[model samples]
Target: MKFRVLVAVSTLALTLGIAGTGAAQAQSIAQALAAAYDHAPDLQSALLSAKSSAEDIVRAESAKRPTIGASLGGNYNWAVGPGAVGPGGTNPTGAFTGSSTFSAGLSYNQTIFDNFATEAQIEAARAGAEAAEYQIRNTEQNVLLDVVQAYMDVMTGQQLVALRQENLTFFRAQLQSAEDRLEVGEGTRIDVAQAEARLAQGEAGYRAAISSLEVSQATFQRLVGAAPRNLSGGHDFSRLIPGTLQSAIAEAETGHPAILLAKAGIRAAQAGSDAAQAAFGPNASVSGQVGTSYSTATGTSSGLSGQLGFQITVPIYAGGALGAGVRKANIEQIRSEVDAMGAYDQVRAAVIAAWSGIQSADAQITAAQAAVSAGQEVLEGVIQERDLGTRTTLEVLNAQAELTTAREGLINASSGKVVATFSLLAAIGRLTAADLGLPVEVKTAVPYTQTVEDVWQELRTVAD
Candidate 1:
């Protein structure tokens, strides 16, 4: 019975020894991150949003240009009237008849001045567009962090499944030994029943681990945009983490996307406030029109004319609308400033939390590793003592269970450490595709912004 149990244990041990060595290809963590950076829907949506914001600059600058319009129409008129000649000739009155008149014209209007309100609006729009660019980085960080967590989850789940399989094998060996001892009249029925119960428990645990693994696999596929196969263990990002907490906080203050976005908001709001104040001043514009008409009743040249004019609109009194706008804009500016200050606090808090998580995970990993080693030694001794009849079968089973638990703990702690390391990088604003050196094209908002910033751009239809 002892020999059969040892053979089964040895077989499983050999299987595990060769598990990491095979023809299967190992997918690295960098590959997963790169895939996520290219395919994540949230990141893609943010990119599109930033592109949309770029158009705002174009719309704001449109006020600085001239607007031209053309029109053509032909109208028929009928009338009968007595016409008298001024020369006092006999029967000089004649019947008048109607005729058709055709006309065409071109009109143009240009804003010559607006108290710099348009300029202020353009500045506000530019600031908003810049803020949108930072939003993309913010979204990138979020998606990448999720990918990191999912990657570690899959790794941890895989380890748990393997551990459960090993436990199932060990339990089967215990059951076989119990049955053999019972047949030889060296063990009670209770021992056999206890072993059977342990085997059943092990099977349940194995199934649970398999379910957990499936969940992790689905999450990995969702975030990484592909099925996970032969994935290597999660990477050690400890080197990417800042050396000190103070350094991390400082980095967040200067480089964090959230803080940058808030600062941009403040600038946009200040520009808006300036624009609102300008509303109280006069708006000046130049307009011109030219038209020619052909009428059968008169010579065509008689209906031709051209005119040019300039106008200024001074805000004498509105139902207090302009004043209200100025007040609202000032309030928004204050709110934006407050939000920027709040963002700084939020970034600092996040850095502290992430740093603490890394420290805790490090300690947990060390303690769990040591426990696993000690548990293995204790199990070996307990098994040996059972063979010498100095320990009960239950004691051997307990020792085996303890060792398995310790190993599982170690697996979770190690995975947590990896996740925490990357999280610290995220907190410090260094968790970006470019910072990580991912082999993918990083989309930027500059190209679209530059394209739309032309003050003399002509209207064109955009392709779908």
Candidate 2:
């Protein structure tokens, strides 16, 4: 009897040893995450967006570079207005004559000075580029968190399906026993009917579990780029979390990518405001051009001309446009500061929420483990009582149902624990490929913007 009870307990409480089976080695969580990292389209899109942002700096730098160009032009005029021609005596209009003129030139212009407006614009662009880097990290955290979610969900779905299958098998046996007892006149038809009802219910539950598992596998394939097979679905993540909730909240508010991005945004807005203010100040520039022109047809002429000029433009009145621009820039600066404040609040809230989820999942797991242990003992006792004619068929069925419910609860809590832990990591901005040490090439903003500051080409694209 003890041996039979032990087997029943093991069936309900044991973790699936997927690796020990004859099947190939089970895929670890890190492997799944690595695959997702390499294949996720969302991550790739974030990288592209960062590259696009890097172009802003290049554009801003262009204002400081020299602008050189060359041009060639030609013109023709007919000589039949007032001059006499020799085609016929004293017939000016009788002869066809024309003068063709051509000109070629090269020009050079540089900012020389712009009252530091270009410098301010360059500073703003650099800040925006830095913000884009943070944005990339933020997107990475979100994608990794999503992968963690999909991984845990698939594991939980498989676990539920296994539990329900075992439960269904138990119900089938109970139904058989009840039928046998009725045939021997030891049980009533009502007992057999109850067993039949439970068997049908268990079958339905098993089918539902199967359907749920299929959906989870589809989601896993979409995220990880492969269908899940022989998943071990276990990891030691408890050590990764902070020792205290307060520490986690502190880390998130100060170090999270969203917070950093918002802070950079504030700097960008300040620089933009500076650039707008500089617009009202006087600016100076030097320009030079050299050209040659030639004409032919009776009055031949040729000459080479060159000129150098220095100009200063002061904005005394710009139809109120300059003041409006300054006002707008100041408002944007204020808005960016507000956004930083809001980012802190959001990050703090996320950390607290995720930490709470972890605590709740831990408590639930502990309780469910104890309940499953007690439930197995109670189920065995109820079965023995029914055999000894001290308990009814309905009592045995109720006990079995309770045990199954406890096992299901245990399964859910176990999976929830892992998911919640990952959520906490994400909240703290540590749920990244580097933190996990997954065997995959970690993509970063550096590669995407390696040469974004090179502004020699007029028509240029970096990393095209």
Candidate 3:
């Protein structure tokens, strides 16, 4: 309960940017994930790439839409020579004549038909966009996993630092006790030297532990977008995992971002192949232009000239280029399908690994807990024996070392359990913000795509 109060106070201070001179904010795993989701530059890059790909849809659709453009120009010309003719009449020898003309025009062009080439291109673009969206999800999962690992590292490091400090303090007291006993002739110099050696080792170990913890804190800050605070070491993401390995593998095979991305790739490649084949089909379009021109020499203006025309292009032969393109696209399509199969296999393997990791961590935690309990009793008994002269200083130190090792193992196994559980969640494609039910708005290309695909706008932008 007191810890809860500290957490509240720390969290409030952190929120207000005045967390200094107090206990660190008890940043929860969920909060860290949310912050990382919001701040991940990797995720942002993916989102941007997805939005850029979404523009392809517009580019493809443009093939079927009418386009209008305007032109304006003014031209001046001069002629000189005996044979040069002027706007008024033939120019005299060595005389120069000039004329100015102004013209303005507008042209409208629309695609009448192109077999199904444009349609295939549009489909391909849409698939590409879909693939990019999957990429964003994949990147999000990766960033969140990184944050989880970093957060856990700092949590584990903090505990290790405290353990090492406690060990250091204990060794210092032991050294003092040995010195006191020696002055009273109750202990030998060897005992005092042994205690001093242990104390020196403890000091070095404690310092090394502090250095490691500081490094972990830096990494945590980099990934979570904030310095590590009083992060809670207790996080169980096993609930997010499927009930069994088979179920988890099935989920990943079907729903993993990599699988989805590969599927989209296949679709896009198929569309590209179709587009390449469509090149053999006929294409038709209609275009029109209207313009007015004035001639200063004639002191006359021509009536607005209008012309309209339609064209149909039927490919006869193209030096084998068209066939080659079709073949290449077909090959790409095949590759995409093969890649999809590979993704399925990879995701299944990852699921298996993560599932095994969770079980291993569980077993380690159990064994380490038992070892820690036994180690404490053994260390206590050895210390008592040493004080009674039945055990030497070295023996007591050895017992202490064993207890410390057990405690460290317990800390590591506990941390590994949480990390392993989260790893399993990530492998099963359930590590997303929505999957975790985080409180941040999910970033997606939907808004940008919807706006860009809607009726054309002269200027449009979407706020990040």
Error of 3 at 115 (Å): 2.6
The CA lDDT at 284 in model 2 is: 86
Return whichever of 1 and 3 wins on TM-score.
1
RMSD of candidate 1 to true structure, Å: 4.4
* lDDT string, candidate 1, 1-464, tens digits: 46345534744563353245222687778889999999999998888899899898888888998889998988889877767655676455567688888888999999999999999999999899989999999999999999988987887788788778878878888888889878998787988888899899999999999999899999999999998877775355666777889988998999999999999999999999999999999999999999988887674644668799999999989999999999999999999999999999988999998888878988887887788778767777777777777887898788888878777777777778777777778878888999998999997778877866755445654331
lDDT per residue (tens digit) for residues 1-464 in model 3: 23223323432432233112223666789989999998888999999999999989999998999999999999999997676787989866686799999999999999879989999999999999999999999999899999989988887777777677767766776788789889998899999999899989888988998899889989888887888776765455557888988999988888899999999999999999999999999999999999999999998999899999999999999999999999999999999999999998888888888888878988988998788678766766777777778988788778778877877887788778788788888888999999899999998998889888875553565454
Model 2, runs deviating above 4 Å: 1-14, 17-23, 79-93, 236-238, 296-303, 448-450, 455-462
Q: Is candidate 2 or candidate 3 better by TM-score?
A: 2
Of the candidates shown, which would achieve the greatest TM-score relative to the real structure? 2
lDDT of 2 by residue, 1-464 (tens): 54246437556345542212113687778888889999989888887777788788878888898788899999998854545656665654455567888889999898878889999998998898888888878888888788778887777777777777777777777788889889999999999899899989998998998898888889899988999877766677667788999999888877789999999999999999999999989888889999988776645546788899989988899999999999999999999999999989888888888888878988998998798789878888888888889998899889878877887887788778788888888888888888888888887767556566656444775555
Candidate 3 lDDT at 225 equals: 84
Pairs that collide, model 3? none
- TM-score for predicted model 3 compared with the true structure: 0.89
Which portions of model 3 show Cα errors greater than 4 Å?
Answer: 1-24, 78-97, 458-464
Error of 1 at 85 (Å): 21
Model 1 regions lying over 4 Å from their true place:
1-23, 79-98, 234-237, 296-304, 459-464
TM-score of 2: 0.91
